[model samples]
Target chain A: MAEKIKILYVDDEPGNLIGFKASFRVDYHVLTAVNIPQAINYLDNNPDIKIIFCDQRMPGKTGVDFFEEIRISHPLPVRILLTAYTDVESIIEAINRGNIFRYVKKPWAEADILSSIDEANKFYTANSMLMVKNEELQKAYAELTKFAYSVSHDIRGPLSGMLGAINLAGEIDDIEEIKEMLFLMGKSLTKLDTYILSMHDYYSLQRGELKITNIDFNKIIDDLKAMYMVISKSNKIVFTTTVDQGEVFRSDEVPLRLILNNLLSNAFKYQDKKSTNKSVEVSIEVHKNQAIIYVKDTGIGILGNHIGEIFDLFYRANFQEAGSGFGLYNVKSAILKLGGNIEVNSVLHKGTTFKIIIPSI
Target chain B: MDKEFSFIIIDDSELDCFVIQKVIERAFKNLDIISFQNANNALEAIKEQGVKTKPTIILLDIQMPLMNGFQFIEEFEKFSPQIQDCYTVIILSILSATRAPADIHTEFNKRIVGSIIEKPFTIEKLLSLLKNMGLADEKIVLSGKKLLP
Candidate 1:
């Protein structure tokens, strides 16, 4: 045995208790309680006691009554009944009410009692494991339900919009009017596509395991710039990146890319279109063990009250524009899985900045 | 339809609002129409208009961000009985796959909602609903056909 399995025996006869303890003390930690109050006290003090074998015919309270009493206060410990008589009626009643694990006939055989103890210990471990796994399954099922609801809501919202716009497009005869409607339809289609991609990101973040590898910061920055080149040029926004790194950092490459991609996209998405000077700056500073990145933008910043809940799923601070609201949530989830931290600072209508610190290991 | 009465749409989706607006335009002539994308703003407008606005029908969307269709009804119920009596609410929902719970349907129906219209809304459905409510009376051009009995 790896360790002694703790057990308690409650009986009225002193000799019986002594004989049971003498036989079983070698294989397990055997504790004896002469009465109901003593057993209750032992149970209160040593909650780790895995099994209890109680004598049925005790003074004042029967073993069934004692088991019923402790079942509520200390429910985890498995209970067994020991009686000299073969009373099927009382045994059936005890099993039905208290969910007694086993019924032992006394004068019990030494081998039978040892075997009962071993079986009870195995049952206790299995029951506890089942309870733990049941809780985990319930949690995972709830999250799946929430994810399904979100997908339906996000997808259907834009689809209805696009369908309405298309219906309107067919009715109009003027070329310019139809063109404007098409532009709006295009926006709706883009929103739907963005939502689909965000859903993809969410599933991958939840299901994919982290792959640790050497990350080249310069190469990642160059790729991001190339990706957002058209967006920056059209919006008249000055996009810049500065990297201060001496050696290659170590982290999950995919998650790092996801985090940066989301933050940079948000920075560009929420930029103040009417502002004369629009800029998004990304700065990365790497030390021997950590990398700190800053994504700063001159944009429509988040409200003070909403900043705390910005990372929440399906949370859109600005309702005028189209967003899946999963961007920041996915970014935060990735950061947590990477053993990293992110913080945001913003001034409404002026600017916003995100600071992230990721450990390189 | 009575010229004194008008149509009001309170929906967060701009596209849905635009579609409803176009449908109303084609259904009737010289009828006043008001629409809002924000529920709070719509509530404020209704409150400011008060008893001045004539008997109106509201098309309320259920899935707004902050203040949903149910919340709007709760707030609208707080208005004076005379002001509340001037409006009949109808729910507009895009989620046809799942219906609202029976309890919610019962609760909203008790207060204001007359019916629910699933998207994408058609001209016939809107006109039939209006006709049932004793609003649309005249023979009108819809989809280049005369709307008849």
Candidate 2:
């Protein structure tokens, strides 16, 4: 059952407060205060109170004045003013200045009061939803600004380097020097290509919906092996994989593939150049609707301080190798979309291992 | 022309460093050119070399990981007056002059920063800038080429 909505009623007369509570206590969690000061205390203590009812004939302060004072501080609660028919001017003031939602007659029937509570509760719910959406919109706007700045910096940084190289290529006459410039230009082009590809992945993950299907670990392992075969063979790094799947597993294939592809590529990219025994190991186990996978590498591991930030967008831990810095961020996003989690362990100059646990949809 | 100055190129991009070095080498012969891929290393080198290094021009890139160009300047400002006077810093960036961060225009940075040069730096721009600074003669010769008429 849903929790009862809280209601607060303020009146200078103690008997009237008890009567109001008795009438609505069954339907709402009723809170009563005999004066404006006591009512303010209740409001400060019970922030979740959704409706406030106050009588206009209170001594020293009227109901409309109390609502007006709290209009800025406790804006979330719906304020309803109770007044005698002779006090028509107070009703108008309540509507204009106090921002009251409705006005109840001083001698109210149970039916009219119940209907007002229902309507005011609906308004409160909608207002709360709007506030939440406003916060989300503001956060997204900030992310968009940062995204624009980073996109411009990453794309132009390389193009300008290539242009500079071309300018120098024209001026220099030495063949060896020109060859070196061409090599650097080639490297810049490669970096640009990698950046564009990862950008495409980032957008797809953002806008695409998950397409869940039965996942085949064997096929995924085969594709990964085939993809890295040439490079792994040439670099003399051993690539190994073991898969144990005793039952059917279900997940979104696209994101799962993205996660493994990024992790494997990093494992290969960050290998110690002089280490003759470079290796990457992958092991997968599926049982009882869960998949646990590990990808371990004998590479120059990340520094301990940088591990916390490696998953952030456009964050790079090491500058020795050319990276788009989108790889791990995209991997984390895809994993989140699949309702899974990832963990990493590494030691500098030794090795690094990534463990991922994904539940079947 | 008689006073030779060393060049310190601090940029994370190797290709940009290579291009800038070649452009400077083509325009002038046998001037000392030092390049660092990281800004922290560059700052350490400046501290270690002290005043023994030649009078230098530091071409700085704005956006880099760990330490950016502005942060580099903040550290550079802490050097002694003699060491600070030996170097002239210029912002070398892909951002246009108008889009550069407002911090670049602060009075503190203004004292140390010589000028802002957009990316794809050219020999023509470098030569004109040096002439305006009175560091180069009005007519300068390219290496192994005739003097500009």
Candidate 3:
């Protein structure tokens, strides 16, 4: 059954209250009170009453006066003052005094009274909804402020550190120190890149649209190996890759790129730089409708305990060491968003391997 | 006499330590550069190196997983005085000043630190860092390349 709207009619004369009830009782859950005190008592008992209809003239207290007394304690019951044609001035006074919804003329048509009640119900519901939405919006605004503060203080903080280091390096007049300055500048630049990527991840997760499309695993791995040649060359680590062609998944390739780029880059990062035989190898295998890509590197592997929580936000194996810690977090969020998963196999001092699996289409 | 020494930069971030090692190696051609990603292992090796006076500097990164730079220093204190004397503490970090209060710059300037350098530390600042630490009489090395104009 539809929720019935309760309405209360108040008049000094018992006949008027009885007549009002006879008119609205079937269509509404109607309550009649022959005096102001009785009306207040009815309102206390029937909390669901949404609209109140009261005669402007009463034996001792007027409708506006009664409403004024209860305004602070029992607010939100929509009020409509009832006045006779001759009491037009009192009706106008009550409207201003009680902030009434609207007034009905005494000896009103049955149809007019019912129509007024219907309109009052609509007004009450609409106002209630707007109030709820407003509260929600206010809550959202508070949360947004906290997010903004964290982004500004933490996200930009490291970038500013880079900027300071760069400026300090530039101040040196030594002819021989230029090379060291540029090298230092490069490190600072990468930290800046990490910060920029962090901002990108946030906006993308919030409002940016990721293009979902089929991506070739073989091609992505090949490209990744080629791109990482610089790190391999510098570290003197052998870059090797093996890929077994597999069916592509329909997912956003942008997130895939970020995930792969970060993982591969991290793999190279921990390699034995002074050892010429050090290497990073990437291979993919397809099985049971799942496409698995493995990035294995003969580098300083992750700690046994750290693997489980590497994907947590703001957690870095090395805090403020170099990476923003946003990389793996973004990858995890991206995978969850795409309905995919990732797993890690690592042993300290031996190496670390990340196995990323996706539904093959 | 131009002396050459190998420096072990122990920092959690391979990138920052790599930059430091590269810059130092370039400036001083004969400065052997070694890198370690963990503190406890590095401390163990540092202790085992035997202190009878060989020229060695350990560029320490402050924040790491198992042990921070200070914690490493605290443990290093347990070593023989002569061995501890061989290594100098140069604090490396992303500076981590964001979580700190507004007066961090004032606090960071306290002379307790031999030198406080930021990450992605460029060659020039590092050489100045070397100069500031009295290690400037050399060339900077980055990724096996000697950075000397």
What is the descending TM-score order?
Answer: 2, 1, 3
The residue-by-residue lDDT of candidate 3 on A1-361, one tens digit each, is: 7977899888888888788778777778888888888888998888778999988788888888987877876787888878785556776667777878887887888877878888898999998889899998896687576556445534444455455445445445675665665665566667667767786885586465767677677778878877988877866888787767645456677777777888888887776555556878877776676667788888778877888878866566743346665778788877766667898888877888888887654
CA error at residue A316 for candidate 3, angstroms: 2.3
Q: Tell me the tens digit of each residue's lDDT in model 2 across B77-115.
A: 999988998899888878867785555566336658888
lDDT string for model 1 (A182-278, tens) is 7766776788898889988988998898899999999999999999999999999999999999877899999899999999998998998899899
For model 2, the DockQ equals 0.62
Say which prediction, candidate 1 or candidate 2, comes out ahead on TM-score.
2
TM-score of chain A of each: 0.69, 0.78, 0.54
- Docking quality class, candidate 2: medium
Return the clash pairs for model 2, or none: none
lDDT of 3 by residue, B1-149 (tens): 24545678886654455446655655566756778878888877887777845567677766465576777877877787677677666666554445433443453424334666665455565567666676545443232234444
- Model 2 residue runs over 4 Å out of place are A1-77, A81-99, B1-3, B139-149
- How accurate locally, in lDDT, is each candidate? 0.84, 0.88, 0.71
- Which predicted model would earn the best TM-score? 2
Q: List the residue pairs that clash in candidate 1.
A: none
